[model samples]
Target: MDNQKRTMNTDAVISIRDLRISFGEYHVLRGVDLDLYQGENLVVLGRSGTGKSVLIKILVGLLKADAGTISAFGQRVDTMSKKELDDLRLKIGFSFQNSALYDSMTVRENLEFPLVRNARNLSRGDIDRAVEEALENVGLSQTINQMPSELSGGQRKRIGIARTLILKPDVMLYDEPTAGLDPITCIDINNLINEVKERYNTSSIVITHDLTCAKAVGDRVAMLFDGQFQRVGTFDEVFDTDDERVQQFYHYNFVE
Candidate 1:
């Protein structure tokens, strides 16, 4: 956000400082600084190639940053041990762009996968109750026995979210949560994002290029431009700027 070194926000669930990453000659993230606070949804707004997804990857340890300090829930992500990182991941839920469901597994089976693997000590009854609660939260209890192929686009998205929420994570990372959905379905997913925060009390970062999704779920919107977050504010405040890069982003979303 600035040339000067900034102190990390201790209260923030996630704190990133002067983050930089590059591939070959293509620099994906120049120097990103951000904070995701407790119980708040921070939306990272950008186009398809502006490193929005890359930022999420860095947060969850899928990708490493070339330079920067990343702290997740008081733990420095850049220097964590393998075992520590795995434990941290369990507390941070990530909903992928595609539903990422196992086509062979039923909805119930999909939800049980993570719980059974990570929380191996849970009994049969515990697993069943967790699956049922997650489905109910997403209002998809009836789809418990159905396969992923049988679900509509929206239903698959809900089930994807159910699988993520089954862990009761402390933080959530949503990668294009409303992508590939109709207008009504997009709105449904937006409402579900908010409901997830309320019910789970989880700090979240929602990555999207969709203006409607950003407006609906974000408490604060950070616009990514040229590998850096040029503007960070509420939905209206970010779009109200006179910066051309910011204006171009808003225009693109408007036309899309």
Candidate 2:
């Protein structure tokens, strides 16, 4: 097969078609179709009021779509049984924009909680090993015993990532991973994301308003506007397409 056909033939880990979501009278997403390829980092960008966060929630089954097909990891999610959703979640992980760490638990325990809850067959030693490996992956082995309150924002975010990593999820969704971090820390996190992708072959869907972060980590970029995807393409293709809305957003946010 030619490169274009080969690209098209590769099955997507996450696929949505004609997805429509509404909150009573307000439409949040409209006929949105998206496909995320294996190990591809696709970034969804949009203005604040757009449904970026809602998109994240839907992909992870936190929110149900009003209409459409939602499939992830070869399973149709739109009508999955509760038991199936639980099984599917074992193969997918979501890191919220807010770290959402449990303040009462130590970082190690926070990471351990999911593993213990989901992988009931795992012994205590196996769970500890997994937690240690996750912490090591995030470069936070030293902070395993520390509380979320004792860590900085960036550290807490890493801990959240560690928690997600402990699940060994096949697809990872990151909502605004770079938000509220200093420039250096943002770069650090971006590099860490790249490292994780390279090491684990983790497919990712990242939603963010951070153009710099998007450009740094995205394999392809999709813009959500007016309850639909305005454009979807490689970073260069979409950013340089000369589309008025994209140009406006780029210039308004990125012009120095």
Candidate 2: tens digits of C-alpha lDDT, residues 186-225: 9988998888789889999988988888999999999999
List, in order, the clash count of every candidate structure: 0, 0
- Could you report the Cα RMSD, in angstroms, for every candidate shown? 1.4, 3.5
Show model 2 residue runs off by greater than 4 Å: 1-10
User: What does the lDDT come to for candidate 2?
Assistant: 0.87
lDDT of 1 by residue, 8-96 (tens): 87988999998999989999899899999999999999888889999999988999999999999898999999999999999999999
Candidate 1 local lDDT, residue 122: 100
**Residue pairs in candidate 2 whose N, alpha carbon or C atoms collide under 3 angstroms:** none
lDDT of 1 at 197: 93
lDDT to native, each model: 0.92, 0.87
